[model samples]
Target: MAIASVATEYVFSDFLLKDAKEPKYKGVRLELALDKIVTILAVGLPLFLISLAFAQEVSVGTQITCFTPFNFSMKQAVYVDSFCWAAVQYQADNSPLWLHKFFPYILLLIAILMSVPAALWRFTGVPYLSSDLNFIMEELDRFYNHAIKLAKNLATLDDRDAEQDSQSALDLAEGCFKYPLVEQYLKTKGFSCGLVVKYMVCQCLTLLVLLLSCVYLCYYIFLASLVDEFPCDVRTGMLKNDSAIPAAVQCKMVAVGVFRLLSYINLGVYLLLTPLVVLAALGPARQSSSFLQAYEMLPGFGALSKFKPIYNDLSIYLLFLKENLSELKSFKCLQVLELLQQSAEEGFDTMCVLQTLSQVKTDVFDSQKMGSITNICEMDKPKN
Candidate 1:
């Protein structure tokens, strides 16, 4: 067992050195799965639609087709298509028809705008939150390990040793298991409302952009549906006096059908994302109580409501933990510590507590092994 332990520690140290430049908390996600899903779909959908729209344009060969007199040659016909496309924007009567030419550009703009909120959060919020969360997780790891070891030590003590050293043992347990690092970190950060404000601003921006995109898509599809063919007056510039060039030629925009389809698809997705953004924005506020209640049973958990700033900060921390719950090992550590805290308070038998703590230690170790395996798999993934 000792040899195995040494080998395991050496391998872990080597892995750490190999990945020294990478983030220590690379497994931790900064955003919720919901946020990632919404951001990906919202931003990716437009880009995909733009590519499809452009592909349709390329496949069709030309965006505008104009009718010419029978006397006009093939070159003249090509000129008509080219001239109508160039002057598609200048035709005041068919202004909405111009959108068919620039539909892909519009989708590109929406994609860039949709991505802004995510970029804002990444730049403005991630650094502070990441450091704080990593620190809390590191401390939780230490605190839980200490608690489990203390439980095992207490379990092995004979009746005489336990009785004689009861005071010292209890003092050791209290010192080892007490909240210090995380609590102190939260206390120092309690007064800061910057993270909350930054988070809200990003969510609100996402909501606003989604709403606007839906509205614009609705308006665009309506206008596009009304006008696919428009009259193009090609008798301008040098051909002003040429009566043979026909006064007004009817031109059809070939790509309008594709644009309309893409618009409907984009609109449907944006509508779906709007509600999700609202839910994400309201999540921290609505769910803070239930999550924070778990920590209430632990020691040093003062009357949180009395200290509003501290409570808010703690809520923010729990919110991040909730976001990263699936990947975070610290959550299990916290659960074990909470159980230990309860056992100590209820005056449980040392042996019974030890049994419970052993199960917890087993679970924690199993989770850590799984996490290490997952990290290895992730590291082996080909870098983009």
Candidate 2:
């Protein structure tokens, strides 16, 4: 039993190690770490402040305090406080002073406005970009695998047959090297500037909102400092003709100081974030070269070069299928046909095989079947 266990462990350990050594590629991140951090802070700070202001209001119990006449009864004084509190809005003569009443709500609005850009990116841009990147990465991976297989085949060729083998290998490499799927995809997508435009627009919008918010906060601070207290007219409704009740009462807004403090904090943070936002907006422009240029220039001839062997192998297989399509009638051939069908269904270019099949025009491969398959393949092709 111990010998069996040892044998099993020895056999499986290499497999586990090999799996562990395999390279894992995560597709590109659309937003940088700094940009994401800044976005969270910029949109989140205002909300936190708003919540703090609300909690303060709740704990303090009243936003307005009215000083009633000493001559009035307790109930009358209470009425005076309630009436003055309700009429506090009427006491403000200017629009700026009136804004103080809705300070928390305004802060909430600022938070929501600041978050719009991030929200838009998450909902609209991220999925589309992520999927596009994943598809490109998958194709690149397949190309890499094909290149590896071709290298192994070339390595095993006998020295005596070197001339013929080298020629065939060279031919295979030539076919594989032509019309790279990723390069073709990039070329087709190169004209579409929609994603770039969307990204830039989002950054600009965020910057604009930040600047406007800072201006509003500064303005709020200026106005809030001027008048936290206002005189309220209590003589209204039932108390309108009452001689005992004072005609006017002095009422002070309880949360104005707290609101002012929150505004200052919000303004300070936004000012810090302003440059970061600007940098994020201009990031794409800084990398003016084509998107894949950096990847192509990496050491060891980069990703595409490393996959050349597998590409050559794939080319050889394609050539074999093309030359002897009718001669190969085994289950493996049917499986290859099924794979071609699947690839056509998935919108891959299988036109080479289709063309070869057309030439043969065998009973097994009828014209109507070919036509329907061709139509399906064409229909499956992606629209730009």
Candidate 3:
């Protein structure tokens, strides 16, 4: 009979283990979809437009036009235009006009600057944060399965005249349920704010770059409009004292109009993006404040309080029992005991657990209730 009973117990335990489903873990996305779309557009549009401008210049085969003297042949006129464009550094009084010559290169530089923050986050920040989140999620899954198995074992115990032995068994099982791994890991990571600080820095850098690029674009547009045409000094090097070559030639940059148009497009898009960058910068601060407020409201609970499982109010209830068991009357205690046993045997939904706690309050505690009890058991609903 003893051997038969032991074999039956093994079968029952195996059945319960097979019946408990392991929770599914979904990966957390480091960047929001909207933010990613905005980054690509804001950084990529100008680059694309600048490439188009360069293509236009190449197809036309002339970036500047300069008229030579009437006596010069077609080849000499071409030489004059080519020489002037190659050395097209125009100086009015003391101010320089080099920006007009290298407008496309400047736009390319701006595009590179705009993309730096996203690249930095992707390479340095995302990997570390992702690994940490995965570790935490896996640990939480293990803790949840452990709790369910303990509850099932407790429920399967004999509920006969061995009441004292059953209570002792419950204490022993609870003692074994302690998970020091998660707590120790958290303690080691408590002082590190590397990920949070990295996120904030990235946002701030993006915002600053956006503002500066807007200002630079506005300045370029204003200056380009005023000084697209300038007098070029062709009387240099070989033509320093030549009587045939003129000392100065009036020349006009052909790509200035296109550059101004590209600047306007870039400025319009960046102006629209300014508000998004501001909001992104503020997101972490708002979340941190809200999280701190919630944590402050819970007195005895520590950092891992945020990690309650979706279907396991009994785990938290057990913690409360450990603390307040002596204070509870026999009738209230019996109600809790019965609730735990039933939950372990048949399983319970969140609503049923809530109703049971409310009954315990109204029946034995004279309508006085612990507000934190409700807060603790309000686990996040699993996403479908």
Candidate 4:
């Protein structure tokens, strides 16, 4: 009774006492490095270009330059430049230079629109995926440790003590094998198409935004090619009756060259991102099954075989596992367990028992830490 009570207490205390060595939740990053890089380029490039455009505007000190009549004063030339820029859109005879005037603002809009997909993924998909990954990873860690300890105990139990109590061994095994928590947890996560839908939505949004921006840029470039200079009649509004002012002035947009260059750069980058987003969306579906099949030789990996259609939640989890495989200790642990299972054919039943027990023992108790049955029974002895 004392041994049983202490075991129960140990289990509960283990839950309350977190391991100092365990990583903090914030440290777990499931976002693909590819996604991060794409997002940075898509959203940052336009903003950077906008800054350049503004800097060019400041250096030149004006957006338009007009050829004023030699009879007019210096102030009249400045006025012509300002009036043509302000009234450029209102002139019916000339091609609208509104796009040229508002080029920096347009680039800012493109940057905001480009960030929409990344923002959607961050808010809608990231929280869900992060929480799921964290839970699955924690469970995997526990299972790995339990399996290692259980395997060691199984290996040395006979050699360590010849007359060890059979009843104590049975008690320990029964305690350990009582539940299969990971499988049960996984089974409950049925039809997690929500994650897939969210992921696809973000990718589709990115593609749509990229395509539209590229089209707009192509059109802008076409328009820019045809018109950089236009005739502007500045003798309107308050100055309509001024006979001294010329009927129209030849005005040129000073920043058209800079705007065109920025457009081409933006278009080129967005085109590159389009293919990357499409690849990211399709890559997982292509490799999910093939990757899992590689692990089918593992004894309990039959669970993975059921993921034939591969879009399910478990498959997604496995996809993430593949992404983070190098960082995961659990994969190495599972490989170790598989090797042990393959080597000990005669003790197959014992290994099966150990694996099953390891899963629950991870949650409920760890008898190996107690050292031996003699140590456990001694705790139950009555004190004088």
Judged by whole-model lDDT over C-alpha atoms, candidate 4 comes out at: 0.66
Task: Give the per-residue lDDT of model 3 (tens digit) for 256-283.
Answer: 7888888899899999988888876554
Q: Model 4, poorest ten-residue lDDT window?
A: 354-363
Error of 4 at 352 (Å): 16
Q: Which segments of model 3 are wrong by more than 4 Å?
A: 1-28, 32-35, 94-96, 151-190, 288-384
Using TM-score as the measure, what is the rank order of every candidate, best first?
A: 1, 4, 2, 3
Per-residue lDDT tens digits for candidate 2, residues 1-384, read: 465334334432321112224333342465556568878898789889878988997899877777777777888767766766666566547535566778888888887887888888778767767665556555544553444345444434566896799789868866885666765664454445666666767888889999999999999888655687777776667768988766667777778888888889999999999999887665554432222232342112233322222112222222222233232222223344444455444444443333233332333655566567567457635588
**Considering lDDT, which of the candidate structures 1 and 3 is the better prediction for this target?**
1
Instruction: Please write out the lDDT profile of model 4 over residues 1-384, one tens digit for every residue.
Output: 465445444433432224547564455666676777778999999999999999998998988889889998998888788878888777686564788888889888888987888888889877887888777766655654554454444433443472474446556655654454654566555566787777778888888888888988998888754587888787778889999888889888888988888889989888888888888777557644444342444223346456554555665566665676655555554454444444443424433333232333332334453234224334434368
After superposing candidate 2, which stretches have Cα over 4 Å from the reference? Answer: 1-32, 73-75, 288-384
Worst 10 contiguous positions by lDDT, candidate 3: 289-298
How many clashing residue pairs, candidate 1?
0
Evaluate all candidate structures by whole-model CA lDDT and list the values in order: 0.68, 0.60, 0.58, 0.66
lDDT of 3: 0.58
Instruction: Pick the winner on TM-score between candidates 3 and 4.
Output: 4
lDDT of 1 by residue, 1-384 (tens): 465345434433322212236556678888878889999999999999888887887898888888888999999899988988888788776467677777789889988998999999999889888888888766654544454455445445555676767667778767754655655666665566778788889899889889988988998888765688878787889999998888988889888877888899999988888889988887656644344444444344434334342324565676787676655453554555455545343333433432333233424445554344434334433468
User: Could you tell me which residue pairs clash in candidate 4?
Assistant: 176-357, 177-357
TM-score of 1: 0.79
